[model samples]
Target: MVDFGTAEVTLEMVQASQIGMKALGAALAVGMTGIASAIAEQSIGSAAVGATAENRDVFGLALLLTVIPETIVIFGLVVALLILF
Candidate 1:
């Protein structure tokens, strides 16, 4: 085992920590956005189903609305990519 108690901080250590933070940020960005989108879609999906059930004509529109929340996930993916690379 290596002891870090008396070790001096180096540039490489700082860079490594920065990279780790970036990775953590990227993961958080993707995870939070995915959860948010999922929550949004859950309510929207239920409402859309009810609307579709009442009127068959609104089925297409409901489908489109349900898909709209998915864009948040896409945006999250972009942000994660930006952070990671």
Candidate 2:
């Protein structure tokens, strides 16, 4: 019976709607963050590995790109914490 933002649909009447929605939201939050970080780090790792495989002069750029995914992870974590807490 709870009203979520603007939706007036009743979960109590919908059986598994409430739980499903909660799980969905949690999944979306974490999944999106995880995906973004994975994609970012995947590229960075590939580039760094490729550079290492080729030569040792690309260390700085590799390190920099490797840490770039951290910002997205932090943002996702903060959002998840706010949602859970």
Candidate 3:
């Protein structure tokens, strides 16, 4: 912006301001939770499946293993809330 003879600003300039790190915040939040879930599920699911495969009498073990991954989500939710608040 200028006086009466100011040159028009370009679209790139207009977009550059909003192109800051705001996007990274969401990406990191989501990425962390997603990674946590993936890691948890992989470990728990693999253990559960292995227990079930190793012994048909291991349903309790499998169940416990399956539920173990849930803790990650719970913990993540808590952390996310802490961060958000």
Query: How many clashes show up per model?
Result: 0, 0, 0
Model 2: lDDT of residue 81: 65
Candidate closer to the true structure by TM-score (higher is better), 1 or 2: 1
lDDT of 3 at 7: 77
- Tell me the TM-score of model 1: 0.89
lDDT of 3 by residue, 1-85 (tens): 5486767788988776545444445456657877887888887788788888989899897887777766766676666555544
lDDT of 2: 0.79
Query: Which 10-residue span in candidate 3 carries the lowest summed lDDT?
Result: 17-26
Candidate 1 positional error at 8, Å: 1.0
- Candidate 1 vs candidate 3: the TM-score winner is 1
The number of clashing residue pairs in model 2 is 0
Question: Alpha-carbon error at 28 in model 1, in Å?
Answer: 0.9
User: How much lDDT does each candidate structure score?
Assistant: 0.95, 0.79, 0.71
What tens digits encode model 1's per-residue C-alpha lDDT throughout 1-85? 9777988999999999999999999999999999999999999999999999999999999999999999999999999999887
Off by over 4 Å in 1: 1-4
What TM-score goes with each of the models?
0.89, 0.61, 0.52
lDDT of 3 at 18: 48
- Model 3 misplaced regions, further than 4 Å: 1-27
Best by lDDT: 1
